[model samples]
Target: MVNGFMGRVLRAVGMAVRAVHVGGIMAGYALLFGAAEARRLLGPRRAGHGARAGGLHDGDRWVKMLTRLGPSYIKIGQLVSTRRDLLPPAVTGPLSRLTDAAPPPSRRRVRQAVLAAYAGTRWPFREFTWEPVACGSIATVHEAVTLDGRRVAVKVRRPGIQWVMERDFALTLAMMRALGAVPKLRKMPFKVMHEQVGSAILRQLDFPAEAAALAELRTNLAGLGNVRIPEPLADLCTPEVVVMEYIIGLRRFAPGDLDAGTRRQVVQAVLAAVYEMLFIDGVVHCDLHPGNLYFDERAGLVMLDAGFVIRLPDEVRRSFADFFIHMAMGDGWTCAQIVIESAAHVADDCDVAGFRAGLTELVQEASGAKSGQFALAPFAGRLFDLQRRFGLFPAPEFAFPLLSLLVIEGMIKDFDSAVDFQAEAVPVLRRRNMLRDRTAQLHK
Candidate 1:
């Protein structure tokens, strides 16, 4: 009993320390950004230029602070980087460059995790590199050759990552609760948002689940001839370690390096695969950041990392498909109605007519815009801002599907600026009978 009490007390002390550290960094940056903004507004012309430089400096400092805070904050930065609507370009631009790379844990730690994962079984690797080829917030991956001479990537979870993440999540929730006490913030579904994000982060620790997701995605996306998913070696996978095919490709590729034909093919395959996942399969991979995707001339679009996958219910899938189809067709009224229907919460004082009008305008503006003309980042930002304005809190099911698309938009635009992102989804929408039903419903 005494030991249990002591453990609780220690955990409390640790969280308190963590809170102060996190709060200090955030507060310091906030003040720095505020001062820069003030200078930009009220100072002389030279001071305005200095303020602009200061903003850029603050953005870099923000990235550094998040990295120093460890995995949870790094992941949070990546997520916030997607919200171009919530923050200015100065902040989001620097954040978009925040990769998940971290210094590898000790070799002893990696070996211990590997041994524990393979307990009671023969060590299967013929050759294994002690140095990690890639290290990220959750795991470090080493190149290995199996006993049968097959090359693979051995991904081992960081030591005590679960405990560390849990502690950070607790502190984050406590902070959110404190924020929730403010009347203006109380309307936002902070608890639900935290639960959704927290659960997804925790889920990444389950290597077995990730392995299964990879297998399922491989099977589901096999029909997309040019898209590839790394096949997880099921026999070798465990909660702590996952061995998969070692894909050889470049995560950063110059578009000009690829022939136009290859680039178009690659872009088409990626869009088709993503649309299939969102509309047809209802099984979506939420993390498609640059690090998790690769391009190979031979292998085509190589998608990696299935650690953050979400399966939408059939109803939600259909609703979202309907929403997208209407949005494409410029049926803004229907889009607005779908938004209301699919929202997780409708505020008691929600401006229903105002929301519908605002969303209608947003959709109408987006309709028929090609990738070059239509930027999903800013559009999503506007959409989210509108939702917040009208007190229509988005369901996680709805939000994640949108995030899956948002994460890939930049890559797609980079690959083929002329591609009509909305129009490209028509064939898939038709395949799912969504387009036909929508037409009939509208005509009736």
Candidate 2:
């Protein structure tokens, strides 16, 4: 057995060496071809048939590339999609296509993972069907019945995921380092943003930690009837596996498959929950994509994947409240102040006047504009360019707002094409401010 294991290791090392040699040769040839292609197509060469066939800026190309590279690269695109502040709309906008879910591992692997997570459980596998109900890069989920016949969703981490993830991350980081050293990327925030996103993804892949976060969120949102978090089944829970209350019904509203009215309600509920998290609860589920949220038509809102929650400091939360108010009242000065404060860490050397001028212009322009009339896609693109064109304010943390702002606003517009963002938001801002004042009075 020892000799056989050693032989396998030696064989594996030989395979790795051969693979690297072939890969390097391929890469060199590809680079030569690519450089020649670029020189011919983009260089001083005559504007040839190349320009015609270049056709559309199909981001789906990148999506397919990531898929072929495997899970880590796929997640990198999703992470990139969120950072509109760091990337131009041209790059970040196309990342939205990266939401295709990962292929599921076999049901046998899922059961083994579950059993491994709960080391002492000799419980028969009969308790849960081996069929995977949902699957993704980090884990797959299966609906199960307990010995007592309780319906629950069993989430099991993919086999050997940790090692593969670690290897992929190391490779990605090395690639980022190389890319950062590139002349074009040296001035951009993509490298820093890449690291931050990698960190976020790492935290999310830790299933035990996610289970704990789920526990806290469920507790915090306990009394809210409109929002629901699945209760973790403690007895069946483990670092690599989590069991939660199964939500069976769905179909009210999601990005796809919703009437305007239903979509609007879903949008409102989602944003309001975000409001509650930032202001009232101080915690937010950061990954707010459609897959992370569901409309349980019979019950209400159901949020999944508690792994990527972000907790804001009190001062930050207050700034949020202030932004909301100023946005509502069209108060440029206050809005500018909040923008400065919110972004102080990023643009330390920024001309406050210029910063305020830019934000104020946007706020005023968007203030009373009818919803569908104003396209924020270009606005997002403009901001990305502003950062690149001007060395003014470079902060990595600012990426979240870049992500949240467009996401929330776009969701509103997507749901109610006729509903102006400023119009809908102003009323909520007024009510929240009023509530704040009354509550403050009671406290005093």
Candidate 3:
């Protein structure tokens, strides 16, 4: 098992390291080449046409480059696309394929993990099957029952998963820092996001942490009759193993698969959870991909995998709240001020005035849309452009908020064509900001 862990870890880490160094540099050159090609093709005679073609060309190259950069960077590419709060979707919009249906682990290895976690201990149940009903990168679930026939779900950690995750995460940070400067991970007030995201990876390795998080969430929403979080069995909780009360129902009934009424309920439920995470709880379940949420016909809603939680410090929360409201109220100066506050350790080479101007344009363009729609894809492009030009960066503190928004945007788009993100977000944001504003001296 140790050898298996080390071997897998080395393989993933080696690949990630190579991807960022070799793949990133090669892709950078390719981008430079493409820019030259487009410029020469259109010349000064048609700069607008050239820029348009170049934009498309850049998009294509980034996807190809990320593919070559290996799995780790590819995952980051997907996160980049979804971060509408930090990025306009335009840049990441084209990179959406990263998180789409990853390959599942083999059944044989999964069984081995189940046996390892249980250590051959016999269950009181007449039959406890070991087959994966659901799957993801590092884990899968098996349905089982107690001796008295109480239905439950056994979540088994994939063998060697921790090794691979840690290796990849370490390599990613190394490469990112090699490319740019960053402070420590979450332990540091001024850390890089590459470092911050790694904390979630580390925390997720310990299943006990996940069990505890679920317990706390249940406590938080215990009285909210409609919301239900599974209870983790205390006797069954271990670092590598977990047993939880099961909702014996199919998970992930996609938006189009249900009747309009059911679909609307599902959409609203998802929206409400997202709103509460951002505005009320401040602790977010950062990964709300379809599979992480369940619609129990009888129980209303159930959320899973609280291990990957993100809680922002109060100061950063205020900054985000202020930024959000400023955007909603069309207060560009306030918005820019809040955005600036949200970043730390910006590049010395960056032009403060130019960066501010770029942000001004972004907020203006986004706010100008006929109904204040969240034009994510285009906005992502502007965000990337801003990042490149001004090095506008994510403080370790805002990591959860940004990630939460990304997940929410994707969920919103799944249901409505006219899902105006700005409009949906504004009201809740106003309330949060008002709270912060009151506590912070009332705009003195």
- Candidate 2 runs further than 4 Å off: 1-63, 76-100, 124-126, 171-195, 221-224, 252-260, 342-349, 374-377, 387-395, 405-412, 427-444
Error of 3 at 434 (Å): 6.7
Candidate maximizing TM-score: 1
Clashing pairs for model 3 are: 88-379, 88-380, 89-376, 89-377, 89-380, 90-377, 90-380, 91-381
**lDDT (Cα, tens digit) per residue for candidate 2, span 209-305:** 7777788888777755688888887767777887888888854333576666677676666666666665566677776654566678563788887
Q: Residue 27 lDDT in model 3?
A: 69
Q: What pairs collide in candidate 1?
A: none
Q: Rate the local accuracy (lDDT) of all candidates.
A: 0.82, 0.63, 0.64
Ranked by TM-score from best down, the candidates are 1, 2, 3
TM-score for each predicted model, relative to the true structure: 0.87, 0.73, 0.71
Q: lDDT per residue, candidate 3, 331-415, as tens digits?
A: 6666767766667666656576787777787787777776526666566557646755665665666657766766656655556
The alpha-carbon lDDT assigned to residue 172 of candidate 1 equals 76
Worst 10 residues of 2 by lDDT: 49-58
Error of 1 at 85 (Å): 12
After superposition, candidate 1 runs with Cα above 4 Å error = 1-7, 27-54, 57-60, 79-100, 249-256, 297-299, 368-371, 434-444
What alpha-carbon RMSD in Å does predicted model 2 have with respect to the real structure? 6.8
Question: Model 2: what TM-score?
Answer: 0.73
Best candidate (score: lDDT): 1
lDDT for model 2: 0.63
